[model samples]
Target chain A: MRGLGTRTVLYQQNVAASLGLYNNDLKSVDILRETGPITAGELSKITGLATGSVTALIDRLEKVGYVRRANDPNDRRRVILVPEYEYKEEVGNTYRPLHQSMHELASSYTDEDLDLITQFIGKASAILEEQIKQLNVKKSKSSS
Target chain B: MRGLGTRTVLYQQNVAASLGLYNNDLKSVDILRETGPITAGELSKITGLATGSVTALIDRLEKVGYVRRANDPNDRRRVILVPEYEYKEEVGNTYRPLHQSMHELASSYTDEDLDLITQFIGKASAILEEQIKQLNVKKSKSSS
Candidate 1:
């Protein structure tokens, strides 16, 4: 449990540091990076953040010039978020050290070991997400 | 780059969501989780956060009862951080989802594909970290 927790924390910190952004700022960047040009409403739903929070996140991101909100061409009522510029180069540069360390670490492992670790991490992540969803549902049900 | 960024963001978000902690809060949690009962100074060095920043972070974690500061048994001048009782359970739940997801995703991939992606990510992360370090060194040199 501690190991998983540590991994999760490092993963976030490393990613955020690499992007030259804080954690909250990274959320918007992440949504745009993954889903691409998503509506604020959709972002709120997908991220499970409050609408107000999403709006504020978008506001901060826009202020930093990392993101822009444009009206969806097909749906004028919807505003879609996009990255101000492609972040590939900047982000790629940020993770170089961790990647190098991982390479060295992996080199010490056999193929089976690497596979087992990867599989373990992946499964663990999915279970965490599912549990979170269940927790959220329980909270909502109790509140209602 | 996109794949790396997305994966990194997801990993962080999943972990944070599990602990019911935010990204910034998770930094301290992660350090404590990894090194176990470390001094604030050690955390600052390991996290690359300013000492002042680490202090504030520790304050927040302490307020939440997630972590505590104890006088070092060997060195009275230093304070060591210890996780509270629930920390393990909290951390354990965080990785459960990720592990499940990895198991499913891995089944779809050939061993070679997994190796390739892992190697690519490893190389890319190293390159990125190196670039950032170089930039930091350049800045420090210029300032001096």
Candidate 2:
């Protein structure tokens, strides 16, 4: 399982390199795609980056047209980071092969077995998220 | 599955940060652990880093006592990168909690179900590995 995790990471880093983007930058875009428009503070929390670093990350991403900063309508004091759909569409092409392969693999499995796998994964993901939260807490405590 | 993969990468990056090491440095250690003693050139290919960068990466890991450069016994002209046991043990401790939790999770599954998950993961990993190889090839071609 650990070896599988490491390979997954390596594959992601390679994908980022292929698109001429840093891994963290691609990760930020992914976060935005998942969460929709969020404040820079939220991005820092989710990504475990310093607030100032998040600012710089957003700047670089915006310059590359992957993301844009917008004023929060409800709270003008806050800036929201939004992913650019066009860039997402372009990068989505790079992942087509991977998705296609995974889809084929999934189809080979019985629906009942797929459900079991999905349930297992979802629970495992929850466990990992909890652990990640704990790690982030430790990180912030030490840094301060 | 993609989300799980991203979380796995994020968790690893956070672990590296908490240990006062960069993600790439930790990844180098992981590669060394898996490949046994490999050459710097092989590390570069595996990591998609430039040869010069690989040299610096090895130097950093060496300074931190996580890796050592030794003369290859079979080929005196080449050097091999070896992972230090002590550091692996220390790093292994950091992953202990995660491993424990995963073990517990596995214990809940029946043998047949566990076998299915393992089989699915093995096939999925192979697919990802193939795609990664193609991406690396593209990256090298463009860079060259």
Worst 10 residues of 1 chain B by lDDT: B1-10
Name the Cα RMSD for model 2: 1.7
What is the interface root-mean-square deviation of candidate 1?
6.8
Residue lDDT tens for model 1, A1-144: 333344434554556654567765675676577677888887776555668988998898888778898998989987789876455676656556656666776777779766765665565455555654665564456558
Instruction: Enumerate the candidates' DockQ scores in order.
Output: 0.19, 0.72
Model 2, runs deviating above 4 Å: A85-87, B85-89
lDDT of 2 at A36: 90
Q: Which one is best on lDDT? A: 2
Q: Model 2, range B1-144, lDDT digits (tens) per residue?
A: 867777778788888887789888888888788889999999988777789989998898899899999999999999999889345665877777788888899999999999999898888888987888888888778879
TM-score of chain B of each: 0.64, 0.92
- Model 2: DockQ against the native? 0.72
Interface RMSD of each: 6.8, 1.1
C-alpha TM-score for every candidate: 0.65, 0.94
Where model 1 places Cα greater than 4 Å from the true spot, the runs are A1-20, A87-144, B1-20, B85-144
Candidate 2 lDDT by residue in tens digits, A21-98? 888888888878878999999989887888998999889899989999999999999889888945566588889899
